[model samples]
Target: MTASPAFERLAIVGIGLIGSSLARAVRAEGLARTIVCADANADHAARAKAIGIVDEATTDPAEAAAGADLVMLCVPIGAYADVARTIGPALKPGAIVTDVGSVKQAVIDAVAPHLPEGVHLVPGHPVAGTEKSGPDAGFAALFPGRWCILTPVPGADEGATRKVADLWRACGMTVERMDPGHHDRVLAITSHLPHLIAYTIVGTATDLEEHLRQEVIKYSASGFRDFTRIAGSDPTMWRDVFLNNREAVLDCLQRFTEDLTALQRSIRRGEGDALFDLFTRTREIRKGVLDARQA
Candidate 1:
């Protein structure tokens, strides 16, 4: 219940799931003196304000960011540059700029140039979210016990990075510092590739004949339902993620394809031992993930 260092104002641009969740966390933990949010969708902005999650909400990024000590960009990766450009001139001197973007390198590239002198850029990803989106989908518990990776570029203000890290910790997240490229590579495998496979498999199932598709939906409880949940994630967010992390995702996809082809060959040849060994190995990996508390 300790209060976080007070910031005059904390601006969140994009009152979607992540943005609204941060607003709730900031308020619940008293991380900021004031929390303001903006969304391109007026309804979303109004909903955030009406829900009392944020102190103020607006439709303009500049208005939201004006004079704020911390300005967080919580929009789709594709919208980062435009939002950054819009809020750049409105940022107060010495303000810290951060983001909850899944992709790190793209965010840094998109926002760094527009920031004025003395402003800090701290790119971060909270490795926790549900498939659902929008302001109403958010809750204060979204961040607790989650990993919040901060990838601050060289020359970023140390104080600013620490302040952001502290804020996440105050919200019950464990903070980790990592290189942007490394963060992207790790997320490519852990998050991006999984989402891609889910999307692909779900899309393929949707292409089946009407009867088969109905049956697929009816009998989806085994494992297909999991994929459906992932595939159900916001289309705009996933699309921007793939476009922004193109190279890393493609690299992981290539490797995944090679491994899948090997498994297909084993199955076609009726190599029981090979299939058994592969499944056992993957099961061990699943165990490892569970043990690491990252599953």
Candidate 2:
């Protein structure tokens, strides 16, 4: 006999790259009996339905969330509070609310208070994506071989957390539990800081003299092209990420600045050994990433 779907209904808010991707994965894995989506962009919502990824689509989050057994927030972090407020009263008791936001503590802060009694909040980050957006950019293949980190707040229901983790596992992601605050700190260095540097580098290149800027793009090396790809991510989403995780991002930025200054001093002093040692260490880190199959 076929096993029952994990949830009776799954409502996904925000039909962007991540949201649509999850919808596709859930359908592919038969994780939910009914799948629906809500997007601030009515066109995007309609697009998701037209693509046949969702059973229903609407611009109102409350409408999508009502009676849903699982509510997944894939909206920008900046919009979390407003979305939470709109959907709070509509959510049914015993429903599980989870998110794919990069910063967990802030997500819990924005969402948990709005949830009614008996509802469970499990903040999650799928630790995966591409520099693409919109429903057409999504595929069920995106989640495979990626990590999904869940940060269930203190006092959160154990069963609810396990269900959320299992949902990701069904989509082919390895799952790990983390403290919300600790998750923020770890992601600050691993994901947030790298994006910040990429945006800065690309912004600098754009500010160069027109001729020089043209040449930079014309003869771009692999490194600069990679930075451009990172910088091409959704602007509104990244803006919220940096603002919501400011404390941790700023801390990492300061440390990065200190290290950069040290590297600058070494270069000025013609210390070849210093540069060589730093490069060797960084090369090993890259090797480690490959060894772990995360690269």
Candidate 3:
């Protein structure tokens, strides 16, 4: 006998890279009996349908969410509150609401109150993405071997949480539960800060003399080219990410600034030993990440 689908109906509220990738993944895995998506961009909604991954597509989040067993807000963090409010009324009893945003604490703050009673919010971050956007950028292979973190609020329904976790597992993700605040703090350092630095470095290059800028691009090394790719991510989404997670990001930025100042002092004072020790420690951290990926 065929096993039951994880969800009777799954509604995704944004059809960009992550949303469309999820639709493809769910369909490929038979995780949902029906899949629907909404995008503020009408063309994106139409593209999602034309691609044949979703059963329905609409510009109205509420209409797509109506009767859905699982509603995933795949929009930027800045739009979370409005989308939650729009879909809250249409959510059926016991529906599970989740998200793929990077920031967790603010997502909970924005989405929790708007959900109807009996609806559970299990905020999640898929910790995987590319510097691409729009429906055409989606692929089913994005989730495999990636970490998906869930941050269920206090007193959240265990069943709903498990259902969502199972769906991610079926997509080939490793699941871990975390406190929302801690999730934000950790991401601020590992993800947010790196993106910020990339943007800054690329932006600085852009501000250089026209000749120097041309040379930089012409002779770009792998390091600078990688920074450009990170900096090329959707500007609207990154703006919202930095705004919505300002407190945590700012805290991390402050610590980073202090460390940077110390490094500058070490260089200015000709303290080669200090620089060597710092480089050695950071090299170990990079090795750890590589080892984990290999394992």
lDDT of each: 0.93, 0.95, 0.94
Give the top-scoring candidate (TM-score).
Answer: 2
Residue-level lDDT tens digits of model 3 in 218-287: 8888569999999999888899899988999999999999999999999999999999999999988889
Q: Where in model 2 is the C-alpha error above 4 Å? A: none
Instruction: Tell me the tens digit of each residue's lDDT in model 1 across 162-252.
Output: 9999889988999999999999999999999999999999999999999999999999998899999999999999999999999999999
Clashing pairs in 3: none
* TM-score, cand. 3 vs. native: 0.97
Better of 2 and 3 by TM-score: 2
Candidate 1's C-alpha runs over 4 A off are 1-5
Report residue 162 deviation for candidate 1 (angstroms).
0.5
Candidate 2 lDDT by residue in tens digits, 1-295: 1899999999999999999999999998899999999999999999999989999999999999999999999999999999999999999999999999999988988988898999999999999999998999999999999999999888889999999999999999999999989999999999999999999999999999999999989887856999999999999999999999999999999999999999999999999999999999999999999999998
Q: Report how far residue 275 has shifted in candidate 2, in Å.
A: 0.6
* Model 3 bad stretches (over 4 Å): none
Which model, 1 or 3, shows the larger TM-score? 1
For residue 122, give model 1's deviation from the true position in Å: 0.8
Clashes of each: 0, 0, 0
